[model samples]
Every structure is written in structure tokens, then in C-alpha cells.
Target: MRILYVGDAACLPEDLADYIGDMGDEWKVETVSDGNSAMFAVSNTTVDVIIVGPSLPDLAPPVLLGQIRTLRPETIRIALLQATEMGSTPSIRLIGVAHRLLPLPLASETVLEAIHSLEELRDLLDSPRLRRAIGRVEHLPSPPHLYFALTRALEEDEGNSGDIAQLVSGDPAIAAKVLQLCNSAFFSNGRAITDLRGAVTRLGLATLRDLVLASEVFSMKTGSNVDRAALQQRALLASRLAARILPRTSAELGATAALLADVGLLLPGVRDERQPLDPDGEPDERPGHTEAGAYLMGLWGLPMPIVEAVAFHRQPQRSSLRTFWVPGAVHVATALAGNEPVDEDYLKSLGVLNQLPAWREMAGLMSERIAEDAA
Candidate 1:
């Protein structure tokens, strides 16, 4: 992997060169002092990753990152953000431009770990054609304003269910979807939830936020061949079932992962990519919805666990996971919600086969309730 670091000598990690050297010839690093130099380097050579520091002499970090995005969209962009820079203009702009953000005064270990994760993701995805296709994609969905508002409300000290509900209610369409999902049999308790506050209280802040995000992103693409409404319903149901499968602590993350599992299907060119041809002229296996979705999440700078879970949700055996965690829960919930068979062999390998019956029971109840509602 070739990395281009755009910053002053002061901002670059002193040990970064040594670290890359230790990783062998597979890794290479190049440092440029200003935005002009960074642009020159990117335009001239193949850079797999670009790191922009908070302070740049010529062009601003955000501007430089934006140019990099346009010039080399496939290159992974990481920014070094100062603590005080949070909520600033450039920082806010970086939200869409940078793939990941790390603190300034960078620690080599943290940077290395982030790089390692990307390396692992590349290996797991293992399709240059898909990677380039996702890289060139310009119309990736942006999380709606409602998601940001909900996030801010959650961050406040006195934020509560009423506050969250009120924020959600400001957007009637989103509020209706939230309430609808909350009342679904997959998420519904014994009683109906009429008010937004009641629904928010039942769903919890994180899950509520995920629902809003999902609702708006799904709403963005209309008139496509894909039945987004039906797809959204299945994703929401899978999210609820995933939450049920996992322990309470990881439930919200699991739900988020499950909710966005099929997001790639919504993006243009993801489902339309042509399969690569082998030397023998046979068509090679193409990257599926899981990879395209995972690539999008990663580009959006979502948490790595959520990205990983989405990537491997369909094929858990492809991952190096011996124990059931977020990926496992998402896999089971997605399969169950879609009325597909679970990978019992994979579950048995992880020694979690005994738990399948309870999950199936949960799915069964969901199906029965849906049938009743439809009738």
C-alpha cells in the first residue's frame, strides 16, 4: 500500500517510516509539506491512502482532501483533527470528504492500527474491480439532517425521550416512519406505541437514531427498480431481530449494523457492476451487496465493527470469527427476517447452534404478528 502524508514535518509521526519499513516492501510512505505538493504527488502516482494533517501551509486540509477525493476517489482519506477543531468549518466539511479522522499529535500505534484495519478490509473484500467501482461512486447517501439533530440531542446532559421525540417530530415524515418501525411486531411490545415519545422510549436513543438514518437514506432513492419500501422494511425487521439476538450492551450496534446491511443495493452502479473475466474467459465471482454496502459504510467513516458486520453478514464463515458477535447476530437476524435458512454449519462451528431455536422462535413470532397485521 502506498500512503501519501500531506502535512508539515512536525505533524508527521517520527516513527511512521520505521513502522512502514518493518511491514516490509508491501508498504510505502511519502510525505509532502503542502497541499500543492500533495496534489502533485497524487496526480503523478498511485496512492492507496492519503493522510491530511490539521495544519497545512498552502491549501487547507479540507480543500486538499476534497481535491484528493475528486482526483483519486479510490484512495482512502484520513485526517488528523485537533481537539479544538471539532465543529469548525473545515472539520464539518471533512465529514463527507475524509474516510476516517484521528486526533492530532498522532500516535504511531493508532495510525498503524487504522491502516491495518483497512488492509484487512481490502483483503476481505478482495476485489479490485469492486473497490474501484465503489471508489468512483459519487452519489453515496449522506445521513439526513434528522440524524445530526438526534445525535446532538443525545449528547446533551439533560436529553431525554421527550427531547428526542420532539426533535424527531419536527420532521413529520421521519417521525411517521420511526413510529411505524417502533410499532412493527419485530419491535413492538405488548401495547401499541401511539406517541413519538413512547416509541422513542421503547427503542432507545441509539436505535432511534439508526432508524432515522435508515429512513432518510432509503427515502433518498426513489423510482429505482429495487422495491426500497420492502427492502427498508426487511432491514428494519432484521435490525430489531438483531437487537434481540445480541446481549443488551451490544444490541444497539447490532441493530445499526443490521439496519444498513443492504444499503449497497440502494446505491447506483453497485448492483450493476459487470463480473470480472478470468484468463480462461469464464466470468469470475463478483462482489455482492454485502461488500458494496460495507464499502459505502467505510467511506462514510462509520465504526469498523458495523462495517465488518455488514461485510460478512451474509457469509459469516468468510470472516475469522470463531465466536458469535455483531456479525453473527446480524447474519442470523438478516437470514431469519428474509425467511432464508441460517448457516447452521457456521453456528455449530462456533458452538452456538443450541441458541438457534430461540432465535427461530423470535422470528416465528415476528412472522405470525406480521401475518396478523396484514390480515
Candidate 2:
């Protein structure tokens, strides 16, 4: 795997590069000082991942991320910031935009973990069966116009809740989805959610934004007889589990990170194949559904953490220096939700499972939720 580390801090970038090399003999790492240089390098070469610092002199994190999405959409982009930086409003927005966000005070072990996660993601992307499965799902309705309007409003200095509400109300489908989600078991606020404006007020903008994305993705009526209901059930269960676990972490923006973890898999570009459940099937060399999902999310301008979570859920130990709880939680949640047995040896080899507390707690919670949803 080749990675481009973009940042102004010479020490941090070099340290990250060295860490990647030391952790995995397979990695080919490079470093750049700014977005322009990073962009130049990406255009000239194929990079598996790009890591950027939040405090770049040439470009803000959000702008750099947006440009990367437009230019080298396939390159997985991650942003590095101090733990304190995660709480700022700008940082929060950047978290919404970048592929993954890692806390500073970097350590070699953390860096290796994140890189390994990325490697797992790359492997998943190359899975031929998953790619074919994703191909069958039809394109969901594009809500880009709504997303644009909402994003613009959020960007405005004077943007108010009313403005966001009005924009959301402009699209009846979005409005209906908002109300539906707010009223569903997902929200479970005792009071009924009867109106779009009220739903927006109650859910808040960030949650609303994510919910809108989720609803749009789920609404796609793929004609395939594949277990669409089961997939959705697992996704919802994973999402809710993440939401529940995030508050326990000290990390800021943990909730948002957790909520968007599996979004990569839901993206249009990730190919999902409905194949026979045969363990003896021939291996595929092409990038699989997970990798396709990660690539597509990178294209769609999702925050790096969310993209990484989607891409690396299958293998969390391979990611860069951050112990991202989102992807970890998704792994546990998805397995539990699907009633799939955990392979302890396989997980231990990945190097992330032991870092987590016993899966029994998470697995039990996920099982209960899945059973309730089924009921």
C-alpha cells in the first residue's frame, strides 16, 4: 500500500511515514507539506491513502478534503488533529467532511493500527464477490440538491435553525423521512414527531444531516431478491450500537463518527453481489464491495472517519494511528446483528479485538436490539 501524508508539521509527517513503514513491510509511504503538493502527487501517482493535518498553512482541512474529493476521488483521505481540536465547530465540520480523524500526540503503535485498518479496507475493496453483489442494487434517488442547500445554509455565518428547517421542508421526501426516523424506534423520544420542523429542532442539524443520508440510501428499491431487509436491519443495528457506545468514549465527535461508520457500504459505488454461499468459491482479484464503498465514499465527500469506518469495519487493526471506536463498534455490531459467530483467532490476528473490552457486552446489546427490531 502507498500512502501520501499531507501536513505542515515536518516531525509528525515523518513520524507517521516511519510508523507506517515500520508497522507493515508492505507499505510505501510519501510525505507532502500542503494540499497543492499533495494534489500534484496524487495526479501523478496512485496512492492507497492520504493523511493530512488539520492545521495546514495552505488550505483548511475542509477545503483540502473537498478538493481531494473532486480531484483524486479514489484516494482515501484522513485528517490528523489534536484531541482538543476535535471539539471546535470548524473541526466538527471537518470531521463531517474528511475520511478519518485521528488525534495528535501521535504514537507509532496507533499509526500502525490505522494503516492496518486501511489495508483491510483495501482488501475488502478487492473482493470480487462483494463487488458483484453491490452491482445489483439500483441507484438511490440523488438528494444532492437538498444536501447542497443544507450544506450552504450550514456554511453561512447567519444560518439559523429556521433556514435549515425551511430547506429541509422544501423536499417533501426528506421531510417525510425526517419525521419517520424521528418517530421510529431509532429516536424513541416518548413524544410523537409529527412535523418536519419539529423533527429538525429535536434531532439537531448534524443528526438530521446523517439521518437524511441514511434515509436516502435505505429508500432505494433494489429489485433483487437478496436479503435487503436483513442488510438494513444489520446497518440500523450497527448504527444504533455505535450511537450507544460513543458516549462512553472520551473522544470528541465520537457520536458523529459512530453514526456514519457503515455509510461506505451503503454508497452507490460499492458493488454488492448476491452469490451462492460457497466457501470453496474461487477468489476474485478485483477490488470488492467494501473497497468499492470506501472509494465511492471518498468520491462523495464523506468525512474520512466515516469512510474508513465503512471501509475498515471488517478489519479495524490495519488503520492508521487512531483507535477509531466507530469501525470497531461496527465490526462487533454487524457480527452480532447478523447472528454470526465471532472468530477469536481471526480477530486476534487482525490486532484490534483485544484492544476492545469483551465483545459479550456489545454482542449482547446488539442481539437484544436485533431481536426487538425483528419482533
Candidate 3:
């Protein structure tokens, strides 16, 4: 894997390069101080991954990344940033080009793990068949206004639950959707949810936020006649199950992690066939859905754990860090929702699943919930 790193941040880039190199002997990394040099390096050579800092002295990271995307449509791009930089304009632009955004105060092991996770993304970018399959689908959903409103709310001190709820209820479509969800068996505690305000008040801010995100991702319409509704139901069920299981594990933001884990599947580029380096499902190596989702999340300015949970859910054993159990829970939940049996043999193959005892109960409860909801 050849990585082109663009930034002036000496310590973070050097540390990240070292970590990538340690992950595999074949990993080749080169650093360019500015965006122009980084672009020159990429145009001249084949790079597997490109990592850029949000603030570059010569050129902004997002502008550089946008250029890189045009030049090398197939290359995996990531934005490297300090934690404080998240949600800023530069960060947003970086998110537009890159598939993953990594935070500083860097952990060596986590960096390596993220690099390994890129393998899955690389495989996807290399596929042509999957890209074509995805291309035929049209009208990918847009990000919900609720997400923007929530972020704005989080930014303001006056952004209380009531304010957030009022903001959300301001949109009739969103309000209807909220009422629909609340009335659905997913949340039907035997009472009807008549209003958006009541729905928000009952679900609380956190859960409502999660629901909004999940609804946006799941509502994507590819126009492929692929029964997106069923897929969305499966995804929703899996996410709900994962949320239930995450509390018992060490992960704190389990619901958020689970809900946004597979957003990559919604991207138009993932299925674009015209791109030469696009992923085709070949036997030797293929970019699976999880990898694509991780890459997309990275571009969306989501936190690292959410990205990791998306990328590594299919292969938790590959990750070095074990503090966040989202990937394992999502994996189990996805399998269960798909009506695929998850046994000890299956769990043992994925090391993280075997270590967690909550999986069985969670799976069972998920099954029951799905059945009850259907009924």
C-alpha cells in the first residue's frame, strides 16, 4: 500500500506513517508539505491512500482533497485532524473528499488498526462489478435537515431538548416521520404518538437524534427496484439490536455507532462503473459493504469509532483495540436480522463476538422485537 500524506504537522504525520508501515511491510508512505506537492506526487504515481491535514499552509486540505478526487477517483482519501477541528468548514470540506477523518492525540495501535481497515475500502475501490451494480440505482437520499439542526443545537448553549424538539417539529415531513416511527411497533408502548413534540419528549434527544440519522440513511432510494424498504428494515433492526447490546459492553455511544455504520452503501460513487479503479466483486479480493460504509462515514465527518464500527463490523478480529464493542455487536445484529444463524462457531471466528456474553441475549431479544413489530 502506497500512502501520500499531505500536511505540515510533523509529529502526527510521522507517527501515522510509522504506524501504517508497521501494519505491513509492503506499506509505502510519502509526505508532502503542501497540497500542490501532494497533488503532484499523486498525479505522478499510484497511491493507495491519501491522508491530509485540515489546515495546510499552501492550500486548504479540503480544496486539495477535491482536486485529488478528480485526479485519482479511485484512491482512498482520509482527513487527519485534531479533535477540536471537527465540525468546522475545513473539516466539512475534508469530509466531502475523504472517506475517513482521523483525530489527533493519536494512538499508535488505533492508527494501525485504521490502516488495516483501509484494506476493505481499497478492495471496494478496486471493484468494477459492485460499482456497476450500485450505479444502476438512482436518487440516493440527502442528509436530513434534522442532522444539521442537531449539530447547530449542539453548538449553542440554548440548545436544550425542547429547543431541539421544536426545531425538529418545524418540518412537517420530519414531524410526520417522527410520529410514524413513534406509532410503529418499534416504540409503541401501547400509546399513540399524536404529535412530533410528544414523540420527541418521549424518545428523548439522544434517541431522537439517532432515529433521525438512521431514518436519513435508511430512506435512500436507489430506484433499482431492489426492495430498499426490506433492506432498510433489516438495517434498522440490526441497529436497534446493536444499541441494546452496546450498553452492556464498554462502548458509550453504541446507538449512534450502530445507526450510521453502513452509510457507505448509499453513495453513488460506490456503484459508479465508469471509474477504472472501481471495486468489482472478485473472488481473490472484493470491497464489502462495511468498508464502503466506513469510507463514506469518514467523508461525512463522523468520529473515528463510528467509522471503525462501520469498517470493522464484518471483521472485528482484525482490529487491535477492543474497548469499543460496536463493531462486534453490529456484526452479530446484522447476521441475526438477516435470519442467519449466529452460533459459537461463528462467534469464535470473530474474536470480539466470542468475548462478549451479551450477544446471545441481545440476538434473542432482537428476534423477538422483529417478530413483535411484524405482528
Candidate 4:
């Protein structure tokens, strides 16, 4: 991979050159001090990755990144930011364009690890599809800070629904939505479930966490043409089915993966040029919704299983698991929830084809139950 570094040289580690040299010829590193030189280097050569620092002499990091994106849309953009500059205006703009962000006073090891992780995920997604999908991703919503807080709270031995509800209640909009959804037939069982703690208990922490994330993200596109309601319902159903399909040990991961499976559809420019699948339900060579969603989630620092599951939910066969796992569970659950058929041949290879009938039955029961609840 060829990487171009732009901005103040002091922002990088002192040993960066030595580290790159030890990695051999597979990695090419180049540095330019200003935006003009950086653009010249980019226009002249094919750079796989570009790391830009905030102290550019000629232009700001965001302006340079925007130019780099227009010039080589496929290049991976990484922004380096000081601690104080994290939430500043420039950093916010960088968040919309850059693929990754590394802290200022960059460590050589951290940089190497970041690149390695990207390479592995790229391979899993197939390089061309990964590149194409990521290139078009103009923005990734900021990580759900509330979701992180809730996750940390749950990790405590004393964590309970009440504490989680208290934390969630701080955001009036989200808290109201939680109550509204919990009172709906989908989560309710006839009695009025009015309290946040009770609703959290009913939904389980994993489900509640994802709901908050979905709510926060979908709310961002309130005026867009996207059918947010339909997408949310589909995600909820898929999550429920995934919880049923996966073993208890892996159920949470499976359910979370299913819940956010269609999130890519909400991203700007991701679906602008979507390609339809072929007659046999085979995906086109271009990365579709799955890859798009996975790329965003991955950038947000979500778990690998969740990222992998979302990436391959439409085509679970792309994953190399010999046994049913989160990806397979999510695939089956998402397919069944969306009224698409499960790939029996794929299940057969994992020796789980016999379980399909039972899953379909569960799905049917779920549908009937929801209908009855609605009535």
C-alpha cells in the first residue's frame, strides 16, 4: 500500500521511517509539507491511503481532503487531530470525509495496526467492492455516545434496567421514543408498559441499545426520501428472529447485527447508484447495502462480528464459517423478516438445513402474534 502524509512532519512519530523500512517494500511512504505539494503528489501517482495533519501550511486538512477525494475518490483518508480539536468545526468536517482518524502525536504501532485492520476488513469484503462502497460514503454518523455509556454501564455487575433507563431518560426525545415503541404492540403484551425501566427490561439491554442507535441515526434523516419507518420495523423483526435463531451465547451479537443490518440505506450517496441483483438473487459485483452499512459501522468502531455479519447478511455464503454463527443467523433472520427465502443450499453445507422449517415456523408465529397484538 502507498501512503501519502500531508502537513507538519512533527505530528507523525519520529520513528515512522524506520518502522516503514522494517515492513519492507509492500508499503511505500511519502511526505509533503503543504496542500499544494500533496495535491501534486496525488495527481501524479496512485496513492492507496492519505494521512493529513491539522497544521497544513497552504490549506486546511478538510479542504485538502475534499480535494484529494475529488482527485482520487478511492484513496483512504485518515485525519490526525489534537485532543482539543476533536469536536471543533474542522474536525467535524473531517469526520464527514475521512475514513479514519488518528490522534495527534501519532504512534507508529497505532498507525500500522490501523492499516492492518483496514486491510483485513478489505480482504473480507473483497478489495474492489470495499473501495467502491467506501469511496461513495460521504459521511458516517458520529458514534453513539449514549450507546457507549449504556454499554459501559451494563458491564458493571450492579447494572440494571433502572440505571439504564435513568441514563437514557436524559435525552428527552430518545426517552419518549423508547416509551412510544415499548407501548406499541411489537413490544407490549396488552398491559400498558409506561415506565422506562420496565420497557428496558422487556426489550433486553442489547435490543434497547440498538434501538437507541437506530433512533439517533434515523432521526438525522428526518426530511430525506428514505422510508425510515419501514426500515426500522424490518430491522426490529429481523433482530427478533435472529435472537431466536442464534444460541444464547451468541444471540446478542446476532440480534444487534440484524437490528442495524439495513442502516446503509440511510447513508447519503450509498444507494444513489444501487445495482439490482441478477435473476438468481445473486448480488451484482458492486457492493450493495450490506457493504455500505458494514463500512459505516466498522468506521464507528463497532465489533468485528457485527461488522462482518452486516457486510455479508445478503450473501452469507461469502463468509467461510462451517457452522452457523452470527452472520448466518443474521442472514436467515434478515431474509425471513424481509420476506426473502433462506438459502437452503448454504445451510445444508453447514448441516443446519434441517433447522429451516423450525425457523420459518417461528417467523410465522411472530407475524401472527404481532397481528393479533395489533388487533
Q: Lowest summed lDDT over 10 consecutive residues: which window, candidate 4?
A: 86-95
Per-prediction TM-score: 0.64, 0.68, 0.60, 0.63
Off by over 4 Å in 1: 1-118, 123-128, 135-138, 155-158, 272-287
Output candidate 1 Cα RMSD: 8.1
lDDT-better candidate, 2 vs 3: 3
lDDT of 1 by residue, 73-179 (tens): 77878888886654343333564577566767777777877676656676656568777776666655665779867755654545777877888899999889877
lDDT of each: 0.78, 0.60, 0.63, 0.77
Better of 1 and 4 by lDDT: 1
Determine the backbone clash count of candidate 4: 0
The model with the greatest lDDT is 1
lDDT of 2 by residue, 126-218 (tens): 556655655545663343456545656665644667777777788788788767777766664569978766777887776677666556655
Error of 1 at 230 (Å): 2.0
lDDT order, best first, reads 1, 4, 3, 2
- lDDT score of residue 201 within candidate 4: 74
- Model 4 earns a TM-score of 0.63
Off by over 4 Å in 3: 1-111, 118-139, 155-158, 248-253, 260-301, 318-324, 343-358
- Report the lDDT tens digits of candidate 3 across residue range 44-133: 989888888657888877788789888997777777777666433333334446656567656656555666666664564345665554
